[model samples]
Target chain A: MASNTQDAAHGAAESAPGMPQLDFSTFGNQIFWLAIALVAIYLILSRVALPRIAAVLAERQGTITNDLAAAEDLKAKAVEAEDAYNKALADARAEAQRIAAETRAEIQVGLDEAIAKADEQIAAKAAESEKAIGEIKAGALESVKVVAADTAEALVTALGGKADAKAVAAAVADRMKG
Target chain B: MEGDIAQLGQFIGAGLAAIGSGAAAIGVGHVAGNFLAGALRNPSAAAGQTATLFIGIAFAEALGIFSFLVALLLMFAV
Candidate 1:
């Protein structure tokens, strides 16, 4: 075994000088080119593209915020308008109620005055009727006295006794008085 | 002269790799910062655009990784 190992070692050393070694010499060049590419890409992004994009985004945000604020303001105004409309409606209702109450009072006063006037007119008509009835009664009484005296004179003539008109009238008045 | 040239080449290669990495990092930071700022502004768009942002970052990172690989190859393989 030892003699075989010695022979193998001698043969390997003879072959070693003739065999080519694996080469890895171009890695530096590859790295240098890659580095140059990386630096160039970085410079383009940082210097050329990012700032414009950022500015556009900022402008968009500003517009959104402004729109939101305007919407909020409009909402507030709408609420205020609603409140004002309600208040105005209430005020108008109150004014209408007030006017209605005043009109009712005026109507009531007019009705009361008209009723009072009618009552006065009725009282006056009743008094005039009473006066006319009194005058009629007086006239009827005078006619009744005249009829009674004529009846007495006719009755005396039928009996063939003369009746003095003035005496008969005085006797009838005295009888009625008694 | 040969020794001086080798030293200069090594120095230049290392410097370029370092500069590449540094520049890549700054670029990645800018991309990430802008992405975050945009996401904050429009959260709804963030999810939809996140994949694209990541892709851009990966591309930029690949450049740096490639530079590192080249440096390693120069030192060890070449």
Candidate 2:
């Protein structure tokens, strides 16, 4: 087995090959150095550089997200303020309308009371005048009846007839009724 | 005469290997040019792709270095 392996390697080990890279004698040395360099680079990058970069990127992302959330919060507050202002304005308008309505109602009540008092005075005055006219007519009729009774008694005596006071009153009252 | 022919062949192979360096330079330029075009189209995304751009440049440059090493080996060691 050893002789067969030596024979297979004879072309590479007989002398220096056309290229140093193809020389089997240096292959292990080159591979060892390459592996060492690769391991060193990997250790430096993974242990020190990559973690720091990742942390910085994460922090930046967090800052951006916080700023966006703050902006959204401020916008919501602004909308709330606008809604409050509109509600206050509507309430003020409603209050003003209610006040105007109350004032109108109060004025109307006062005017109605004043008009009713005036109408009552006018009605009372009319009733007083009618009562006075009725009293005056009654007094005039009484005076006329007295005068008529006296005139009839005088005419009966002047005609040479016996004048009866009671009869003369009865005749005057009956003629007045007609 | 045999040594002379081998030396001639090595010189020719070394000259041919040098052409790979130029090809690698073209590949690097193509990668960089496409990256610039994309970056110009969307400047906002340019910063994020910078690492990728560097990786592509390094890979293309490595090929050029490899070709240069091959040419040197042919000229000196072979």
lDDT for each residue of candidate 1 in A1-178, tens digit (9 for 90 to 100): 4455344334434554212232335557777999999999988888887888888899999999999999999999999999999999999999999999999999999999999999999999988999998899888877877888888889888899999999889877787678
lDDT by residue for model 2 (A47-154), tens: 998999999999999999999999999999999999999999999999999999999999999989999999999999989988998898998888898898888888
TM-score of chain B of each: 0.78, 0.89
Give the TM-score of each candidate: 0.42, 0.37
Off by over 4 Å in 1: A1-38, A130-178, B1-78
Q: Candidate 2, residues B1-78: lDDT per residue as tens digits?
A: 123465567567888999999999999999999999999999999999999999999999898989888887776565
Which model scores highest in TM-score? 1
What DockQ values do the models have?
A: 0.03, 0.10
Model 1 residue A66 CA deviation (Å) reads 1.5
Location of the lowest summed lDDT over 10 successive residues in candidate 1 chain A: A15-24
Candidate 1 residue-wise lDDT, B11-73, digit = tens:
468667767777789888888999999999999989999898999899888888878766654
User: Candidate 2: fnat, from 0 to 1?
Assistant: 0.22
Error of 1 at A155 (Å): 9.9
